[model samples]
Target chain A: MGEKIMVKGTEAIGEAAIRAGCKVYFGYPITPQSELTEYMSRRMPQEGRVFLQAESEVATVNMMYGASSVGVRVMTSTSSPGFSLMQEGISYMANARLPAVFVDVVRGGPGLGDIQPSQGDYFQVVKGGGHGDYRLPVYSPSSLQEAVELTIHAFDVADKYRTPVVIFADGMLGQMMEPVEFPDPVDPSTLPSKDDWALTGARGRKARYVTSFDIDPYKLEQMNLVLQETYKKIEAEEKKWEEFMTDDAEIIFVAHGTVGRIVKSTVKMAREKGIKAGLFRPISLYPFPYERLAELAEKVDIVMTVEMSAGQMLEDVKLAVMGRAETPFYGRLAGVIPTPAEILEAMMKEIRR
Target chain B: MSEQVKDAILLASMPKALNGKEFTYCPGCHHGIVHRLVAELIDEFGLREKTLLVAPVGCSVFAYEFFDVDGTVAPHGRALAVATGMKRAKPEMFVLTYQGDGDLAAIGTAETIHAANRGERVTTVFINNAVYGMTGGQMAPTTLLGMKTTTSPYGRDPKREGYPIHMMEIMRALPGVAYAERVKVSRPQDVPKAKMAIKKAFYAQLLDVGFGIVEVLSTCPTNWGMDPVEASRWLEENMVKEFPLGVYVDKVTEVMKEKGVK
Candidate 1:
């Protein structure tokens, strides 16, 4: 463990990326996440790395695609609208099987929604926002320390799977500050070699090219099948979640990210009121802890989902519960962050029903 | 007779930087000529083993297959932005982008302009063929004022569609641009000049200066509805008059002089 330092969430993510051997960062300024870009602009030069403020999110994501193709670690941070603009480039990088990382500090929006924090981008990030058959390994961290840890882990996951990894944070997380103890900086030289597939000038080897295109439908289908296999492997190996006091609980609350930590409070409130409550928080949104959630649903009479959006993750909770438990949802829409008391009251209503 | 046959010498052949595969371009399309020039320059610079080409989303989309160097295909109009990332990440490697008029001047205008403005140390070969050949002769941004095409069948009207965009003129205005030139291969006499401009553009990167671009006024005979010879003549007469051929910016020589080299 390294020395503990107080840091903002976006800046901590930037420092974590630098420590994780990220060599290049291309980004465009958007609210709530611009500090990460600003942080990189200062830190990358000091580290003898590349940091460029792209003309737009469209350009920024393509730049990531370019840098990643060269077998170097690259990343970018953006808010919801910028993330929306990056979808096309993400699809390209995903199909090309290039490894890269992105941090979407989600802000409110159907379109230019306020800069307030929101979990509105759950479907956009976990479900394929980009046009294609692809899945990104998305990590939702509940605290600043978890945010720092996940940012570093996302890079390794991206390289291991040869696909894009996303750190699904939000506006509140971006603004909040907390003391974080970072792991030691990774020595880039000691990292796994990508020379076999990386575009390293093709010297002393047969010329190589990377592309996601195949003019023939049969060949394209084969490529998609390979992608599907990768996703299946990831789903099998990467499901992660945290269960708090669920060993003997009758009601379990499902949540993730900032709302997840808040629901921990809700769990405490419910337990004090003698309702036997617990919390289940998903860390990996794509390879969701479905199997465990289903098992927990069998033990609990009610599974309640709380979110900062209009219950987008509720659909997944329902799918996991599959009517084994009475699944109810409580959500605050349009960038509203619900308090623990509100969530506890909502849980009580479901219990009474 | 055997001694005479054995003594025969080879004068000219294909460039080694180019893979021996035949091009898919239609007869009289200038993409073949431009590809040869680019490959020859890579060979001349001895950069074959240290080059990365960003292939565009046009007729030259398969340029990666043609060039015997490491490369990848960028989505339509994002080649320069992609190349910017490549060059920045690996400054030691020579990066280049090959884009057509539609891909560069239309869909990728922002990427092209901003890349130049940022002075990214990458080379760009822009092919201004006045029409989108791959998509069956749709009117491109560089299409002539009165030119007829699949989309502009009634001849381009300045009222409905804007005038032809002069990308070289745009490049000249950018402070980050190190070299910007407009050339052509319409006439046999113009081929060497086109190659020279391309070489200068490549030198802008090789010399560690700034952004470099050479807009080659090319022809698409099939799309232009003319025979090969007629199309060449038409490009020379019409496109040349609209987009004047010359060096729009030349910071390469100044930088070379500053480095105390010829």
Candidate 2:
């Protein structure tokens, strides 16, 4: 709380994860997120931790799954395409109820689109990217300080729920530098022991099994029911968002991550122009603060979403609004970021319409 | 009842490592034998309490049900990679992966190669049955030339279908591998020899040597359209030609000699 220093977004996230008691980091080099991997490779060994440059993203995520299965703090960082490759492993972890953190510094995508920030992976992350009925508690941080705080929070959330948690910052947050203060380092020994479910040699006890395969249809359905119940609990307890000037506002701007910060600036711009505008920033994508958005929709005349995608989050926003308000969307697709002026212009037009 | 009990004398029995569950493999399948050998080694090494097995996705997907030790199942061809994760995370435990040819030689080729290349101190028990057992006898990466199966109805042609992948030979060349062997359990005489090879692979990991694998040449009679006896004979007569038996790597013996372990 007292210290301040300049740190790259990726480095801040990595350091914060370390301070949160992460003992193993397995990752491959990928654009916009390579600095995070490099940071771990340099710092983990100093902390007496494991830092491995895996053969591929496929192997890296699987490695993370293995490490996490043993009840250890393990993680991996990747960009969009690499995260796409990690989908199978992520599903496996979720199904096995293994706890781990995954950092997706999302870049332009659909297919290796470009190396720039994009909230394009919103659906892929918030919605399940892999097979099965699974959800990763997604954290979208708007700044380097938020990235640090969210990363530490990610591990705790993952461990507390015994499910995989994701930090979904895009390229802009990963590559940009900002002043941040990391929390005090955590002692790995003090963390909860995974002996209950981890593969730590079943000495003097019944052997433990970790797998997602359930051949019987009835049994598989029951397994999914169990997972769905967990998701319900998460939705009930973990929905987080920041409301800015929503009171007395006629038009509300819904955004997250870097897009949310931009919309905050645009809200000021629109206010200066004598238009009533406010910002709604969702911190958690999955377990999304949909109820709040719904509440705000009833009060606001227009529910607008601004994104760095064609319009992924708009689907969720509209679903939340459910025709309570007129839903309008503005986005710059394929790695193009929306400026405050462009967003303000869109907000003004929405108000005028 | 006393007289009947007296008449029953046990010569050899199942290893204590088996959980007494019946195998899900088809009749005449060699997975039972291979599983027994692994179980025997687990019993012999006293690794039951300290062993973690990674079961692969083929016919042996239910292997965790048979082994008494703690276990996990990996996606197709990713058992070794998963084992690498388990072993790295818990180095005190002895980790072993049971994978079929399709899982180890085909889709998991990259994982198998890299786990070996990185020299993860783990043991791999590879079952090379030359056919995809669980999915109904499709042509596998190790499926022999001219072999007829569900996918290769016209027989596998080397030019079109490619030759059987000799995995032990391929893995032997990797520096990370401390020991690699291809053994067969086609006949009664071969069972003990195969068991010995599997034991050596386990010892390699216990000694912290390197990655070790024993590619067991197994039979899939249900897929091959042969009875148990015929399948055994067939493996001896034909499958042996494609995947010749013997050690492909032997640093375990070298390490044992250095440490004065007999």
Candidate 3:
């Protein structure tokens, strides 16, 4: 354990990336997540690293592609609209199999909706947002401490799979401050060498080339199959979820990120009223813990999903439950956050039915 | 006669910096000429093992296959932004971008301007052929006001479409630009001058001064509806008037003098 220091969620992610040996950061300023870019601008020079404010989000993501092509750890931070602009580059990086990390401090959106926190990007992040067959590992953290830890872990996953990783935080998490104890900085020199695939001037070896383009349809299909295999392996090994007081509960609430923390309070309230409720939180949104959730659904009578969107995750909850339990959904839409009392009331209605 | 002719000295050959792969360009396309010039400069600088090329999405999309160095193809018009990242990540290595007019001036104008303004230590080779060649002859940002193409079948009119863009003029105005020049390879006599401009652009990056660019007024015979010789003549007569050939900016020599080197 290292010394605990107070930090905002966005700044903590910045420090965590630096500690994880991120060598380059290219980003454009947007609301709620601008602090991370500002933090990198001030800290990267001190650490002898590269930090550039790109002309726009479109340019920022391509810069990430360039840095990652050379086999270096690179990252960027953005809000919803900015994240939308990055979809094209993300598709390119995924096709090229470049390892990189991105932190999307999601705000309300259909188009420039609001700067307040919302999980409205659930569909865009969990599913393939760009124009292709690809999946990015998404980690959603409920608190500032977990955000710091996951930011470092996301880098490891990106390198292990050689694909882009997303830290799917919301605006509330970006603004909130918490005491976080960071791990020791990973010395970049000590990290495993990427010389085999990285473009390191091609000295003493054959020249290397990296690209996502193949005019031939048959060859492109083969490339996509390889990506599919990687995604399957990740699904098998990386599914993560948390359960609280579900051992003897008759009802369970499924939620993630900020909503998951709120449901924990709802579980306590339901338990006090002798309703026998518990909480199930998913940490990895892409490689969703479907199998485990199905098992829990078999044991419980009712599975309720709560979210900050109009029940985007509910579709996944329903798929996982698959009629094993009676499924119901409760949500607050368009930047509105639900309270524990309101969630508890919603759970009571389901029980009464 | 047999003894003297048997030991003749070779004057020129292919550059070692280029892989032996045959180019996919059409006959009389100036891409082949510009590619050779870039490769020659790479060999002269002994930077073959220390170079990274950011290929753009045009006829030169397969540029990585032609260059005997580490490289990647960026999305259309995003080459300069990608090169900026590559150079910043590996400052010890030489980085360059090869882009056509549509990719550089039309789609990627912001990336090109901001990268030059920021003084990113990377070189760019801009090919101004006045039309998009890969997707057929479409009207380009640099297309002449009276030129006709597949998209602009009725010769370009300033009332409907704007006048041709002069990228060299834009490059010269940027404070961070270390070297900017416009050159053409239409005539055999102009080849050496084109090579010199490209060599100076390479030095701009090697000397760690600032951004460098050389716009080559090239021709696309197939799209221009002219034979190879006629296309060359057309480039010399028309493109030369719209894009004057000369050094627009030359900070490389000043920096070289400051460093006390010739």
i-RMSD per candidate, Å: 0.6, 1.0, 0.7
Tell me the TM-score of candidate 1's A chain: 0.99
Q: Pick the candidate with the highest lDDT.
A: 1
**Model 3 residue A247 lDDT score:** 90
DockQ of each: 0.84, 0.73, 0.80
Q: Kindly provide the TM-score of model 2 when superposed on the true structure, using C-alpha atoms.
A: 0.97
- Which has the better lDDT: candidate 1, or candidate 3? 1
DockQ of 3: 0.80
Q: Could you tell me every candidate's TM-score relative to the true structure?
A: 0.97, 0.97, 0.97
Q: Write the per-residue lDDT of candidate 3 for residues B109-225, one digit (tens) a residue.
A: 999999999989999999999999999999999999899999999999999998999999998889999999999988888888998998888889989889999999999999999
lDDT of residue A347 for candidate 2? 75
Runs of candidate 2 exceeding 4 Å displacement: B1-11
- Give me candidate 3's TM-score against the actual structure: 0.97
DockQ order, best first, reads 1, 3, 2
What is the C-alpha lDDT profile of model 1 across A1-353, one tens digit per residue? 88899999999999999999999999999998999999999999999999999999999999999999999999999999999999999999999999999999988888999999999999999998989899999999999999999999999999998999999999899999999999999998888898988899878888998888888899999999999999999999998899999999999999999999999998898888888999999999998889999999999899999988988989999999999999888999778899999998888788778
Q: Mind giving the per-residue lDDT tens digits that candidate 2 earns over A1-353?
A: 55999988889999998899888999999998999999999999998888988899888888887788777898899999999999998899899888999999999878978998888888889898999889999999999998888898899889888899999999889888899988788877777776777877778888889888888999888878878999989999998899888998989999999999989989898889888888999999998898889999999789999999988989999989999999999999889999999888887777667
Q: Sort the predicted structures by lDDT, highest score first.
A: 1, 3, 2
